[model samples]
Target chain A: MTTTTTEQTPVRGGSFEERRRRVEAAAYRIRHSALNMGEVQGQGYVGQALGAADMFAAVYADQLTYRPEDPHWEGRDRFLLSTGHYAIGHYAALAEAGIIPEAELETYGSDDSRLPMSGMSTYTPGMEISGGSLGHGLTIAVGMALGLRHRNSASRVINFLSDGELDEGSTWEAAMGAHHHQLGNLTALVDINALQADGRTDSVLRTEPVADKWAACGWHVQRVEGNDVGALLSAFDAVAAEAGLEGRPAVILCDTRIGRGVPLLETREKAHFMRIEEHEWQICREQLTNGYEGEGK
Target chain B: MTAAPTTPRLKTSAMIASFADPGQKTTPAPFGHALVKAARENENIVGLTADLGKYTDMHVFAQAFPERFFQMGMAEQLLFGAAAGMAETGLVPFASTYSVFAARRAYDFLCLDIAEPNLNVNIVGGLPGLTTGYGPSHQATEDMAIFRGMPNLTIVDPCDSVDIEQAVPQLAASDGPTYLRLLRGNVPTVLDEYDYSFELGKAKVLRGGADVVFVSSGLMTMRALDAAKELARHSVDVAVVHTPTIKPFDAATVLGEVDTDRLVITLENHTEVGGLFETVASAVVRAGLGKRIVPIALPDAFLDAGALPTLHERYGLSTARIVARTLAELG
Candidate 1:
């Protein structure tokens, strides 16, 4: 609800236990909202929503600075969602941040709804770039970072990407570009969930040693368990500690499962996208609620 | 296909600078010089290129404003993506690449990132149509045709150094995204002779004729004017109309020129199916002009790798070929 000063994130003032607990609770709500939206569509990228929930929460709830009422505020930190299909989770995160109303979650994927099936800036408030096509986010972030530095703005850019985008040559090009520009204001958070369309990520394409690849591209790299709120928060903290306007850009590669918390969906073979039966929606929510222990609302 | 008896047999490298004819008035890097002047006027303007600063004439702006110039390696997608990103942060980015790369390779990036958002990113594309002799890979023969489908993009096909210089200030001042088919590096100054003034989306009638009218754009406009002059010596009066802005075409001016029962011809450097030919013919058909339209355009095929002047003549876009096509259609 308050703005984070340039020196410290909103979570920095809180104790580690307190900060992690708040982020975990937000992640739980984010995952819960994602499941509800998925039921509306009958099938969607719900696996991605559940998988990348903690990372989104760490961004909106703890790391990023934005005014919900003023989503277009020039001073606010930017969160670019590059993989546009992750709107199920992104809508939840936006709702969680109060950038959009939580009640709007029910309108997800419906005609005339602000929340569409994919991320589009034309429809939603607080959605910076219209994304769906892969490998486009990081390059835009590089430009935004440079623009901000040119204007001498203290705002940071946090671009969200998926591991599937690593296969896109444009992503590597942007990685090289950001380092060439030495944009410390840019921070890329990659959701490394190993499931993509046509099968597991490895089978589709071998993108292992992603950290090394990013490092070779001249980025400050850190690979962590994406589902852990604490690890994710620490990565942001470490990045924040050394970031300057003229320095190497940072990338935190978070390895995550397709379906993170819900036991019923986690083991599902069709995990790239999920099609939970009407009755199974309740069970998935129950699994999420039961798995959550961050002082439930 | 056999080479025409009239077509020149010059060696490849000798005619690469075919656009800059000997002793003709010209300006070097009009696009670059104009952009530098624009950047000087507006502090928010920035220049970007995909390792094509030299080719696209963006290097002039780069040299003028090195801090604002960004060379995005040999990556077209990154160039556009970064331009859109910079636009979002309130900077006007003039991004350049070969038209083949911008129109075909990075169409999606242009569509979603710049056009969909309606950002202020100017796309200056070099080697449009048959300007290059580097075969299909470099020549952007279908640049305008491909960009015609994209909404909110203003497509400009400049005729000469004067056109590029004038269009630069206007393109930079306009709010939304635009695609400029750049005439770079020692471009001709033919339009200055007609007392021409470049308007954003308006067409100009260079000269009046009673026998035939040539509605053209790009370098084809230059050929039409030359052909019109040649046709006068043959006792035939030919009208020349230059429509540089191809997307929001000056259909009214073009259709006005086609009102007479004289033979109608559409001249362009692009294929006959799309570009200015199709635009003029489609408008004529829709307006019930009932005129039989003749086309003087490049064949809808992969063109050969050779000297520029020879390729132009072989494809019926050279001045002599235009005069020949006009007389045949008239007969």
Candidate 2:
């Protein structure tokens, strides 16, 4: 029970264009780190990491209040990755935030590395729970949010879940629970990439009317293009502005591409668990760098 | 059967009755009352239940501290996950639900979210080992077996109201995750008559005899005492050993009461496969006692729904059955 509160600089202070440039730069760095980590495995959930890079950048770079030196700070906002296999993206964000050394990105999936194949709270700093089993992170986040509210702490709980997670019954259970509790401090960040292990998310399980489903569960819903740093930042700001006021939890449905920065990997078939060929790695990096340059960052 | 009554009979089919008791002593509010007392001293103690507050006696806590009580609706997974999260923020949460739900439905959440981190979450499970007549669905006969293999979980099956009253504060004071078999509502009071107190992992020997030694837990200890009285008339001396904590079992205390010369009978309200029988058997084998042990427990099958008295008798868990089995073994 250390009651240490980390001071959070208000994310809404800077000009819109300035914030966008900074966020785009951070997202670019996160994508680079994720690509480096993927190169270590040669075969990993690299598509998801790349796809979720912007969302991660928005939170860690601007919105989340945290101490990079102290991941266990009591006042820090919790980011729970329900889809554990997306650890590459989270690790990149952590590295970008200076929570972990950028040098550690090279050891992502290596033996004895803190960055495991999946997100494990015990193994990695800033990871809230061990999430490989889908649909568990939201429930845990609900618990954490409720706990923080009971303590009268100002900390927030943001849970990251995939579209495939919407198929799990427990996810709905947690969704309803968060609303019933009126967890204003909780927000669900759903990555609706429309791709899963089997095939398309809609083909496997139709989660099309996803925004309506979250609203029906009593959550304040916001849908946005996940890879667009401007849209992502605005959605986060809106959610944070609603904190501690509305008696409803908020959910941001992020419609993202599997591989956003690199065009080569974006259109690749069966990109759920991707295996980028050795020569393709350098080309993907070059494309990502060129895209960042085109963004005028 | 006969022709149905034409006058719209009230369908009481879903209503199941508890085992009828002739004695019908005033059941004590040990668990709830003790929790209230503990919560008064420690503000971090919160109560949670998955729509079983009244059934599990959590309503008492809810009434006493409404702000601290969280009704997690009918979701067991959220019940446990929320409890874990509360523990993460340094709040000790006692989450209660039926044993079947905690052990069967939300087991994975309990394993990874609670036990893996070894959070200070106290899970109180009701309707353990045929305490209800709601059939196998409600009966948590295999709860012990399910939780035994989970790392960092401390399991306790308290015998009576007194043990529960004492065990609550002790569990709240301890730091890791614990699974306690809850005897809720009007919990029977038997341990107080023997001046028994609960120690976390220690087994207490209530009575010593020369002919047979009975190692028991939960309500079976009461039956063992009753059977001891009946066996005394036939010139049979019996010893009763009460083991409240099933995991971190007090094997030393159990084996000490075992006179290699006397018949050792392990009794429980759980299945014959993995409860006290297995724990005591392993202890005996490890000690090389070569003692012939008999396990008097429920059959390894889904139990049928019936009155508690009939179910006990039919399943060989009654006082009469215990006496008969002991006498047969002695002869």
Candidate 3:
């Protein structure tokens, strides 16, 4: 594994304001990368990629301890993408984190590209597991956590799951297992976009009182606006601090929009798998940039 | 509305009691004991079970290495998925469950999560090939067939306690995914008497003869050896070739022993399809030996729940049945 120098340093010792600014910048770049990758494919799970960009930024840019170049580093914290279709967001984050070259973003979802439409561990670097199948990442995370504990490794495991995956029984089984083993080093980040491939997540299978369900399963629960970089950073810090010491796993229920930054795409119906017109590509990018500039002002 | 009369459901406990009583005897510790020994030597070795710790003999590992043992409840998918995760973190995880669950319930997990990446996860499957009297649900008669097509997986069907003890350390030392058929709790001892040592993909000739040869695996090898002795009384000599490693099958050894004049029989506790029978027959056909090859294996159907002796006799897996089949084939 080649070791690449990280462009951004850890947020430790920085002021809360400074850390929030850095995280917001990282999230901004991640969203930009997602838009660029989406333009390459024209139609994909671009909505999911855009919505979860902030969460991915929080994990890769702020919380995760990893070498951008050396993804197979034994001591690095693992981030598993359970919802494999969210690879667009993860690829964006990877590019921003220097794990993958930002220039390679154009090759996403293309033939002979390392960045496939779905996240496959065999195809891409920094991908911990191949996960298109829902409800498998959390269980794998539980196992990784147990193994790390047995080896006395301080590495943490963070699994990214979607709201639609909550319907799988294996997810709950892993939830019970995480608590049963007292794996404090494990954390689950749920992207509750309220949409799935079938239809609305709730309509497909209601998973309301989500925070309560996790809490009942003995997890340290935190519900926050996933698009808010500051809230995501705080939630991660709290969970990281309590992990291993609390003897309980952690979960953050992130309520996020399907398409977050671009105003034109945010309210689009059936945005689960967005297909923008060829001419609308430049317009989407303009909306994203304009929105980011307005937020900054 | 009139209430319909419902048929009484058969009680599982009553069904269990009707099976022949497994007589109490001194049974040696099987895979779990060997695993404990290996775990003591290697800190990275861990044990996991899907609510079958006691039944699968993983309780022994749990007691020995309390901190390293993981009980994943009854979820077979989680059991295998977690084992793959453990393997990712540089741990040699021996994940055990009933063969039926591992092959049928959690096969996708094993295929994608474990076997796809070729992780160092040892999946120990208990109740292989009619070891249990609980009917088709527990009997893994077709497990070998289910896992045969999977790539990067080494399948092992140990003959007895001695073979299992030897295979455990080898499995730990091996770096890829493996599926081991397990015989738990007071497992029968057979290979030790023949001074047998397990080599990963090699077949050992337990006994050599000229008239007929039995290519066998699992406890069926022990039955073949017993049948060979019975054949000796009828002035017929039989050779026994034990092929414990099923996937990377030792075809050379099997073909080396084959002759056009002698009858070659492939016997296994599993179904004939995609098991030892298919493996040996395919190799023989490829070699164009033109030898008469006979397959004496279990039927590719759900077996009836009964005593071990009765099930063995019905399926032609018993020593007596094997001897009779060999004689009938010879005549």
Candidate 4:
């Protein structure tokens, strides 16, 4: 019998390292673009976009498998943005992926642009589902996961939902549906920034012990510091391992801060739509540039 | 009633399709048959019910595809929400429950998730209007009016078994989302006059008369046809347009049929406001048709229910009542 050698193992050194660096740079570009686009639009939900940058970085960089040239490739992994207001963040990621032109990022929330404040699946490419109303995306994610399972494909479905959305009754229903179906290929990334438009989520509906809730719902839950690249990668690896086990769906409760890197915006009570002073643009741009350089490969 | 040896309805040149020659079945059985067949054709097609699969005749689909069928266990709100999710994944889901529960209990989910985004889910409602003996809780007299206001939803209230049979494949074949009011199990064979070549959005004109036009939809079309036969006894000629697609009404066809002086009667098995009657009346006025339009529909109230036949007459929706109302308005 011919022995298969260890040489068949795909090495994770040269191109993979370069891809990681490129993705980090892409994440920086997305954050830079989102901040600028939010400014141009007069106002937007920039805090959520700012906080989700690093988590977005790792998925696009090393975890997800897709060819940017063909956004609709059947074999590509699907990314569903459940919180519609965070189209600001999703648009940045799609632009980084070359699904949309980078220049189009400036047109967010504009009258004629395909990029609306809340995402509409019909108008935009790579927008897997229409989501504006809270607690809607998980159900669609369950459906897509079931579809992939039916097709017998390994392509994973990732649904990004906000902590604020967890208050919705439908979200829990979707959580019940996903685990009951035994969708091992599904992964839910909860952007737990602890802030809604009104106030902090704890002050609002208070989804205390969120991880416990997901655990009780039968999902294999993992808590991660969302902004750390190492933590994100580790969480993804664990999720992949669980998928290999073929037992249950997974949720990564990503702890993050609202207005993550920007000092002035971070201190604001309502970071949803940060209105920067004309002179403060330099400060925001400087912070993003420095943060990108420190994380640059 | 026994069939006469010599036909009174029509003396056909072709061999008469006998009603009693040991070959005829008065009730339409094709609705239950097609649902089971459709389930076998597509494995992705899932069946959902809120404690009502057998009563609605969706048990046929359930029996054929047990693995895909999900009995939502009396939670109608979750029933629609889950079905909407299933539709998002490219699955063709047929959700069946009572018309009232869907129209009232789960209106929010139906409007927000399924209708607003336009997911391709099929809603099959059983005992539409006054089709059941069960009282106010079961009688969905105002279902059509309730769903008519929701945008991006295609509403099809099939009159009989033929429409139900044809609607299953047609709704599955169509791209956008739809809500079909079902008349399941021993459904009356009302629209057998046509071979059931029904289109999704187009109205089918069943009879021709220039004197009076009866624009009706759903089960009320059966009453309209019966009334047409009765009105002809007094030499008061009438035309009947059986329109099933209520949302995107065939306004042009309805306006064209009603002459400037001829009276138009709009009938339905739902509340007068926001139902088919108001829908047709609005279209007639908008199309610049100056014909006098009268609405014959259930009043805006919780309907008291008995047997379907009794309730239909009690609420002035019967054939005799329709004829009397038409003559009273026209006379």
Standalone chain B TM-score for every prediction = 0.95, 0.94, 0.92, 0.88
The 0-to-1 C-alpha lDDT of every candidate, in the order given, reads 0.88, 0.87, 0.87, 0.77
C-alpha RMSD over true interface residues, each candidate: 0.6, 0.9, 0.6, 2.7
User: Which residue pairs in candidate 1 collide?
Assistant: none
Cα lDDT tens digits for candidate 3, B93-205: 99999999999998988998999889999999988887877898888899999999999999999988888999999999998999999887777777778967999888999
Q: List residue ranges in candidate 4 displaced over 4 A.
A: A1-25, A294-297, B1-30, B39-46, B67-89, B104-119, B132-139, B149-151, B194-196, B209-211, B233-235, B305-310
Candidate 1 structure quality by residue, lDDT tens digits, A102-184: 99999999999999999999999999999899889988998999898888888889999999999999999899999998989
Tens-digit lDDT track of model 4 for B1-331: 5776573432221111111112333464455578677766766677888788877777877777777777766667667876776676678878888888899887877887688768888888876776665667877888888898998889998777777877888887777678888876566676877545678998878898867888888878877887899999978888888889997787777777765466788888787878887787778677776667788888888876444555666788888899899888877
Kindly indicate the candidate among 3 and 4 with the higher DockQ. Answer: 3
lDDT of 4 by residue, A50-140 (tens): 8898777776656666656666666767788889888998889888766788888889998988999998777688787778877777766
TM-score of chain B of 1: 0.95
RMSD of each: 2.6, 3.4, 4.6, 7.6
Q: Which of the predicted structures, 1 or 2, would earn the higher TM-score when compared with the native?
A: 1
Which of the CAPRI classes, incorrect, acceptable, medium or high, describes model 2?
A: medium
Greater-DockQ candidate between 1 and 2: 1
Pairs in clash, predicted candidate 4: none
Alpha-carbon TM-score of each model against the true structure: 0.96, 0.94, 0.93, 0.87
Q: Kindly state the fnat score of candidate 2.
A: 0.72
Error of 2 at B295 (Å): 0.8
Worst 10 residues of 4 chain A by lDDT: A1-10
Compare candidates 1 and 4 on TM-score and give the better one.
1
- Residue B12 in model 2: lDDT: 18
In order, what fnat does every candidate score? 0.75, 0.72, 0.77, 0.30
The DockQ leader among the candidates is 1
Sort all candidates by DockQ, best to worst: 1, 3, 2, 4
